[model samples]
Target: MRELTFENVTVRFGSRRRGTVAVDDVSLRVPAGQVVGLVGESGSGKSTLARAAVGLAPLASGRISPAPHERHVQMVFQDPYSALDPRMSVGESIAEAGRRAVDVAGLLELVGLPGDRAGDRPHLLSGGQRQRVALARALAGDPEVIIADEITSALDVSIQGAVLNVVRELQRRMNLTMLFISHNLAVVRYVSDIVAVMKDGRIVEYGPVDEVLGDPRHEYTRELLAAVPRPAH
Candidate 1:
């Protein structure tokens, strides 16, 4: 069965002075337990599409069918610091997953955070720690799908690896269907089984990661590959 899908989705916003179509007509699907990377430059409707997939963004036209409640879609934002609350300590923030808001020490441990760090606020924790907490909170709902929108962009190289590993493990262990949205090609390639490239608010090219990344068919996709900086071994 299909885990998540967007059919001919269109999102348009008409403000007081102007109107814009953030997400053009887009249709996508991710099978259960597969990770599909939505690769695009900023404003290419990556986040907008991510939100739409999870029913956060109202679809102006077309259809969005989320799986049943037990198989609901979940989102993981890019900025862990911004996504988390400063008023609550890391433990308290994670504890929100509980029905009555009990301690989340076990949750912290699951995300690789020390139990002692539970009392620290977002400001005190490192970029990686905050993200771990975010992961714990998002998983608190026990979602079937997790939308990670450039969640590691704000972290250091070392921290990026840590967060990505956690996501990868969770996907494997839980058989999660995920939409990993990012501007970073390397990161996308690392986590995705398949990739779809978006341009001008539409997916112009898509295929298996090896095929798309190894031999890009689209001009924009080739350009994206060329712009990537490689490290000399």
Candidate 2:
């Protein structure tokens, strides 16, 4: 079952980044029950493509289709700082997910946070905490698929491992179809079963993660692989 499909999608933005296109005539299908990593440089349009898939951004051309019946869909943003309401108590916020037909407590636990963590506010929590809260909210909707847009970008290195592991474990336990977008090839390789490389807004290469990451055919992809900055711990 194809969970999401971007058919001949094109999106362009009037930006100062020369030769940069958001997404250019890219066609992609993320199959059901797998994680797909969308990778590119800062302006590679990976995020733009993800946003379009989730109906957050409109396409300049082409079609975006969600899974049939759409049990639910969630987005875990890269920047946890701006994704949530500072004033809203996590419990209140999560409880609101009741509107999405999910149980708030179950959502919190599913993200690996204690159910009580739901009562805290974004500002009261650490960076990882905030991100988990956001995840809980996203899951609160009991989504069948999630569009994770750099959801771990703000966490500490140690925390990143924990969160990544949580996501990996949950994906299997719950059968989630994940679209993980990032600039880091390492993270992409870690979480993705399939990989898609975007360059100047177009999908230059795509295939199984090991195949594309281990044997990249595009110069841009090789350059991206080479430029990955290792963490200084």
Candidate 3:
């Protein structure tokens, strides 16, 4: 597994003079073979950072180590339906992103999907299954690091757990280094070893998931934790 690093990275949009900064001088790391969860509310720059990591969003300044190359870093986008082509069968999509001599069936089975479902089109699968296909496609690239941007936010609550289970299992089985971005604290807490809380366009607090969530030092982190709904006794 390879580690991902961001050094004072900044991403801007539009003209330099008038453009807004989507990610502002942010620095973080996803250690090799570890899951780093990035949590923040809407427009907090979490997704922008993920995009910048994958070379989708251009950076105005600073640098990202190992560079933004598709072979090393792959992203599993939130909306699998839109991410995959409607005309292409599941096998074709995975093969397209993968290197030569790819195991399309094995990749499908790895994500808990049947090997025979390769011929099925994206529209025929449920939201959760499409997301699994997306995961398989990402794995086909043989990437050391994966940037999952709110991957489960688009799915139904009942199906969310199943997809997340696949992710957790894959991470353990493959020792995949990941940047799991989500707005849900519970989900982050469940999957992440380290947690980073972002507010506005910067990370305000970051540490081990237990420490950061259990005893938050930053006000924003505390507020986010407090916002999680608790079950009645």
Top TM-score hit: 3
Off by over 4 Å in 2: 14-21, 67-71, 229-233
Over 1-233, each residue of candidate 1 has an lDDT whose tens digit, in order, gives 23777889888878625878888899888778899999989899989988877667777888876732343666889887788888988777777765455557777777777778888889998888888888888777667778899999999997799889988987787778888999999999999999999987888998999999999999999999998998999
Return the clash pairs for model 1, or none.
none
Q: Assess candidate 2 and give its lDDT.
A: 0.81
Model 1 regions lying over 4 Å from their true place: 15-18, 67-71, 98-103
**Ten residues in sequence with the least summed lDDT for candidate 3:** 62-71
Residue 67, candidate 1: Cα error in Å is: 6.9
lDDT of every predicted structure (CA atoms): 0.83, 0.81, 0.94
Compared with the true structure, what per-residue lDDT tens digits does model 3 show for residues 136-184?
A: 9999988989999999999999999999999999999999999999999
lDDT of 2 by residue, 110-168 (tens): 77778877677788788887788787777777677888998887778879988888888
Residue 189 alpha-carbon offset, candidate 2, angstroms: 1.1
Q: What shift in Å separates residue 128 of candidate 2 from its native position after superposition?
A: 0.6
Q: Rank the candidates by lDDT, best first.
A: 3, 1, 2
Order of quality (TM-score): 3, 1, 2
